[model samples]
Structures are given as structure tokens and as C-alpha cells.
Target chain A: MIHINEQQVSLSGEHSIAELAEKFKPDSDIFIVNGYPADRLTTVSDGDRCVFIKKGETPAPEEFQAMLTARHTPGIQEKIRKARVAVLGLGGLGSAVAAALAKIGIGKMLLSDYDVVEPSNLNRQQYFTDQIGMLKTRALRENLLRMNPFLTLELIEEELTENSLPSFFHDVDVLVECFDSSQMKAATLRSVLTRMTKVSYIGSSGMAGYASNNSIVTKMLQPGIYMVGDDISEARPGQGLMAPRVGIAAHHQANQVLRLIVGEEERRRDEHTA
Target chain B: MNILLNGQEKECTDGSTVLELLASLKLTPESVVVEHNHEILQPEAYTAAELAENDQVEIIRFVGGG
Candidate 1:
């Protein structure tokens, strides 16, 4: 017998596995009293408490995955199976972001990019010579499928216009902004905040010019946006844009997405407790 | 001489023009934006664009955004 989310749930110490499974089969994600992920009927020792958190209550999928795999947890696979994300760029940062999300089991991705590949892009963008003439969105779609055959990708190869931004973000759990221009970044951010309902995370200023380690910073912006790059302030004409920095930013964006999914209960709990 | 291209330092051998560098990178002529020393380099001129020591070259990929 233990307390779950303040509710008392009594379990006989000798209860069989089937009985325990029935008790835990409510379709909710479960966590242990120790903040570990757990499933129903998980072996319990004396004084171990359990909490059941309802699924679909979180916005981030990666956090849910971590919790699913966390010791003493039921597993976050169901939540991962339901996630849908939109990636709004296919350049260096966008390529890394879309690839990471697809590989991590995101059920679907809405990939949007208008450019074509160029040889110079090989220095930072995740594309090969054979894809040079292909549209960026189409190239990313093919590449992502190779990485995750089960992934469902919708490729949109036009520039993001005022008319398209709202509809593009509809039904998406999260938006990954990977634009390179400050003007476009500003426009996208404005649209996401004002016109879109789903939360968004943006990446700006990856290796843009010649700066050292001090140039790269990964941080949250407001409630949903994250910026990854070297100091936009220190950018020379060609010193801060490259693959390493862009990849780093994309990783951070992916982590934040994960954090949103699995850590919802904990985050809300902490918020309430604080 | 060395110039920074998209954050990497590349050696600039004598007579290495922007077009030569673009050709070396195998970049398609119409697909990217090149900024040399703060000025946008047009596609046709990329062939003859000469880079100086310490110049910063930013080859940017355009992406869809609202």
C-alpha cells in the first residue's frame, strides 16, 4: 500500500503479477516515488510508493522517452508513438534537427525548406553531392527516411509565407525554427507566437563566423523557444556558421523537446512546489 | 594566406579566386548565397571574385521561414 499523487493505493505484498498488471492498466504513464520511470507491477520493496501520471499531458516527447526508459518506470513508448513535429528549415541546423527528431522515433515530421543543395553546403549542411540540385525539403525527406524507415515525413518546398505559417504549425506538437536570416527568424518567431497554437523552439546563429568556444551558447527563449549558436554579437562576416556549432544547437533543441514530453509532471510539480 | 569560410579557415593559395574556391567545393552555381567581406557576391561574378588575406567568406543556405 502506498500513496500515488496523494491518493492511497493499497497493494497486497503478495499480490500476483497478473493482479498487479490489472491494477496498473489504466493507460497512464507511471513513475515511482523516487522519480524513476516505472510500469505497473514493477517489483516493489517495503515503503516504495508509486504515482500514475496520465499521458498526452506533456508537450515534449524526449522527456517522456527518458521517463519511459528510466529505472522503475512503465516506459514512454506509447507517448513517442503519438508525437508529431514540424521542422521549418533544412539548412545546417534544420538538417541536424530533423534528423535527430526522426531517428528518435517521432511518428511524423512536417519538413519545410525552399532551397536547393550546393557544394558549399557540404561544409555544414547535412547533404551529399548527389543531392546538390534537389530541393532541400525533398532531400531531407529522403535522407530522414533512410535513417528511420517508419518515419512519416511531409515535405513542403516553398518559402514560408504569411499565408502558410499558420496552417503549417497547426496540429504540430512543436516547431523547430532553423532559419539563418535575422529577418526571417524574427518573422517566424513573430508568427509562431502570435498565430500558432503549438509551442515552438528556434535555432539561430550556429557557427556563423570565426569565434572560439565562447561563441556557442545553448539557452531557452521564453516558454518554448531555444537559441543555439555562438554569440551573434561576435559574428564576423564568415566566422560563426558551420556544422559543429549548428549540430550542437540542434542537439540542444532536441533535448529540450525531450524534456518537455517526459518531465511534464515533474516540471509542473516543481512549479507548484516552488 | 588564410580566409575564414563559414567558420573554417581555408588556405588561400595564390590566384585562388572565389570562383575557383566555389568550383573546388563543387557547389552548384545557382543554389547558394556568398557574402565576401560584407558584400553579397552575385552568381556571375563569383568566378572572378578575388579574395584577400583575412577576408571572411560566408556562404549561406537559404531556408524557408515566414
Candidate 2:
């Protein structure tokens, strides 16, 4: 049986997060909730919602994971397996991001990048020497599949323009912005801000430089817009970037995506306490 | 010329470095992103760097985000 905070309720077929929020009023201060690890409020199974409660009322990580895993209804698993995510770059940051998402069993991934894998990218990007000269999307597809055979990865080997933004934003739960070029990053952000509403989260990664210590900061831009990077560090116009710094930034980006997948409100509340 | 610390432009002694300006404004290095002359200025270089005349600086505070 399904319930929202002790009141019994039933969700029919597929529904948007808006619909669920409208019906349940789950945003209330006292409403404890859980489910949809990737998207807590979007749509979830009976079992997932059963465990949700007020912000500080939850169980420990081990206990919670056990409950969610043990009660893994086919419906919830199917939802996770069918989710579509779009990654907007394939550089050091995007490459590692796509790999982490793939490992977590995200059903389908749309890898977008028009650039070719260069020797310079090997230090941080997951691509191999054999992948040189290949389009980044192609390389990511092959690499992701190797990580998880069950994943369905797609490729869009083109620069994102105003015209392409509409179709690209369609049906995706989240968008990962990993462009290296500052101009391109700004353009993509401008277009997405104007183009779509289906995009629940747009995670943007900024300068992840060679310095390991000073190059990691994660800022939540808005409800769904997050900017991950040192935001403070930079490479001199002609300087080179290394692996560890970019990898740390990439890892932070992936962590935000996971937090969005689970419950952003909960995460925000926790951040406040910390 | 007067330059803003956050939003208020206060007079400062000549040859003030970014670090000195930050101190004058009572701002911490960890809490702001400085933009000077239309470019995003890196925090690490802010200390060794000096401010110039007619320069407009935008200091944005860092907030927690996901």
C-alpha cells in the first residue's frame, strides 16, 4: 500500500513531478519522504515513498540503503533503468561524469561533444590511446558500455546551438554542462535558460586547473542549476591542465547529479546543518 | 578613482593590492569571486596582484549549491 505521511494514496500511471507535488504537497516542512534516488519527487514506487519522512527523521545510510534495495520493486528499478540523461561535453570533466553515471546504472545516456579526443585529454578523460581521432561521443559510448553492458548510451557529435537546444533538452531529467571553452559554456547556459523546462537540473563545470588543492568548489546555482569547479582557480591563458584537479571537479559534479537524483531538498537541508 | 569593495566604493591609499582591498572591505578571500577588467580574476593571484586606475571590479559571494 502507498501512503504520503500516513495518509493512504495511490499513484496511477506515469506522471510528472509537478503532478505528484500538486497532489501530495510533499514540500511541507513536516512531510517526510523518500523514493526516486535520482529524482525524489518526480515519480516513485510504493515502497520507496514508504520510507520517506521529515528532513531529520530518516534512518542511517546503511539501513536506508538496505531498505531501498531489499524492497526494490520492479517498477522503481525499471524507472532508473529507463531514465535518460544528457551530458553536454566529453572533456576531462564530462568523460569522468558520464562514466560515473553509467556505473550507477542510469538506463540511457546521451553523450554530446563535437570535439576529437586529443592526446592532451588522456590525463583526466577516460578515453584510451586507441580512441584518438574518434569523436568524443563515440569514444564515450564505447567506454560507458565497457563499464556497464546494460546501459543504453546515445551519441550527439555536434556543438549545441540555439536550434539544437529544443530537441536536446527533450525528455531528459538532467543536463551536465562540461564544456572547456568559456564562451561555449556561457552560450549553452543562455540557450538552456531560454529553451526548455523539462530540464530539471543543469550542472555546469568551470575551471578545474592543475593545482589539486585550490581547484574544487561546488555551488548550487538554483533549484536545478549547479556550477561545479574551483570557480576560483584558473589556468593562465596558455597553461596546461592536469588530471587530479579536473578529476576532483568531475567527481563533485557527479556527486551533485546523484544528490539531485535522490532528493535535493533533503540534501539542501543537510548542507544547512553542516 | 573610487572602486567598490562589494557595492560601496571607499577611498583607499595608493598602490593597494587586491589583497589589501579585500582587507579594507573586511572580506575574506574564501568567500568571494573577483572580476576585474571584464575577466574573471583567480583568487590565488589576487594577493600578488595590484589594482589599476579606471578598473571596475565585481566581487561575487560564494554560495552553497548542488
Candidate 3:
């Protein structure tokens, strides 16, 4: 069995991609096998996904939306498309998280950060070197828009205090804490997990230094609070925040947000009680 | 006395206040977030919230980094 353009097909014997294209899409000008552009002669086996596209035929917005949903499990993409995720602190972690959700077609993003793109931040942040000194909110919006033109971003350029945090995030379904300061990170978590009980709070603690990537993880602390990191490796003198470790932790948060958007939180609780 | 702290069972002296526990753990009040019996306590409340037997508390250490 194989999936072609998200439709399942049963094969009776071994076949090359060209053969499948002839049978399924005779006018196919290009082939995408396993999510990568492929040569026609490439042999397709069981469970492989192949998409045939004609050259210069860019999918329309609705067709583009269909293709994105085709890659994900059924019933999940719509939830992702409708989700309103808030990212606090458009630094390395927050920028990457928002970028990932944008790529996956998240409907709306509420992003806040007061810092500017500094030359120092280029080491880990997604901002371009040319964007140095620009507000993080502006830089992130420009980048995310380039990825998904359909994305709706609500950008706020201010340092969020405990009192100000909830006001901007009350309507969000998930709030990601990406503050680089320990004090503000704690303050934001306190604000959400206590007052914003309905919102899932995804927070990162300690992705610092050149630690083992395997050490970082996403764990649900309780029902609503999920943490992603080693929770101990604080940035200090010798150990600095680098791209690899920060990206790993940030991806964990992004993956968790997608799961929560698809109702994995509720599914987990049901399985736990069962 | 027995208490549940951060999902782990531990023993602390009965009546140990939250501030005392943070001090014993070498975690400054400014560096951590504390939840006592599932209620997030304000920094000022830490001094008054005392630990009791079987009480549930969680302390998450926060550090500077993305």
C-alpha cells in the first residue's frame, strides 16, 4: 500500500514511480516521493508517499491548503488552522516556535517581544544579520509571513509584566513562554497556570550550553502545564546558548503545541483514566 | 513529616514554611516558582505558607536562556 497525494493505493507488485505516475497521473511533470522531489525512475515501495505535480503549476491557495492538510493526519489540520497560539518573547525559542507553527498552517499567532535583533542574537535567533537593531516583533512578522502568507499575526512590542501578560493572552488556546530572563519566565508561568487555567502553558526551563540533545524533552507536568528542556542547564560563563540546543528545545515546544491543538491533551487524559 | 514535592515524595520538618523550603534547597525566592497544594503562591505568601504532612508542593527553577 502507498499514499499518492494523500489517497491510499494498493499495489500488487513492485513498481517504479514512473509506472505509478503513468497509471495514476499520466500528465505528471514532477514527482515528490517521500516529501522530496524525486526522479521518475525512483522505485516506490510500500507505504511511500508520492505526489505528482506539473511544472510551473503552483497550487492555488485552497489547493495549497489541501496539500498541507494532506501531509497531516485527518481531523488535525483544521484544528491547527483554527488555533490561536501566543508566543511570549520573540527570541531564539519563540521565533523558531512561531516559524514552525506558521509552516504547519497555524491560523493565528499572538507574538510579543520588546527586544531588538542584536548582532549577538544572530547566533541562535532566526533573524537575519541585516535585521539587527529591528524590533523582534517586526522581524518575526516579516519572517513568518514569508513562510505562510495565510498566517495572521498579532504583534505586540512591549515587555510583558505579570499584570500585562494575561490581558493579551486571555483568548489564546496555548501560551508559550520563551522569556530569556529567569525572573520573567517564572512570573509569566505563575500568571498563566494560575489565572489562565483554560489555556495550556508550554514553558521551557534549561536549554543552555552544549549539552546532549537527548537530555531535552517535552513532559506534561500536570494536565495543563507542559515543560520542554533539561530544566537544569542554565546559560553561564563557559556554557552559552547555541543554535542546536535552543532549536531542539524550541521544536519540542512547537511539537507540543501541535499536539495540544489536535486534542492530544484530552486524549491523553482519557487514556490515563481508562 | 512526609510531603509530595514536584511529584516526588520527600520528608521535611513539619511546619517548614515555603520560604524555609526554598532556602533549604538553596533556591532563592526570585529564582523559582512555587505552587503549594496546587495554588501558585505569591512571593509574599511563601513566608506564611507552611508545609504539612502529605502536602503537595511544586518548585520549578527558572534560569536565563531561550
- By lDDT, the best candidate is 3
Ranking by DockQ: 3, 2, 1
Provide per-model DockQ scores: 0.03, 0.05, 0.52
For model 3, the stretches where C-alpha displacement exceeds 4 angstroms are: A1-59, A267-274, B7-14
List the candidate 1 regions with Cα displacement exceeding 4 Å: A1-74, A231-236, A264-274, B1-66
User: How does residue B40 of candidate 1 score in lDDT?
Assistant: 57
Per-residue lDDT, model 2, residue B29, is 60
Ranking by TM-score: 3, 2, 1
**Poorest lDDT segment (10 consecutive residues) of candidate 2 chain A:** A265-274
lDDT of candidate 1 over A1-274, digit per residue (tens): 6444433466556543234434764555544544666655566644554445666454234443433334324445556557677788788778888887776677678888888998878888878899999998888888887766667788887888644788767667777777766546545554554466355545464455434656566655445555566534322443545676567666766666666655542111112110
lDDT of 2: 0.62
TM-score computed on alpha carbons, candidate 2: 0.56
Error of 3 at A133 (Å): 0.7
TM-score of chain B of each: 0.81, 0.74, 0.92
Per model, how many backbone clashes are there? 25, 13, 0
> Candidate 2 on A1-274: residue-level lDDT in tens?
4554434566655544445555665543332345323344455555435333345544444333334343454455445556677888888778988888886667678888888988877877899999999888888888887766666788887777645766866577777777765545554554544455446444444454465555577776545666777654544455456677777777787777766665543222212110
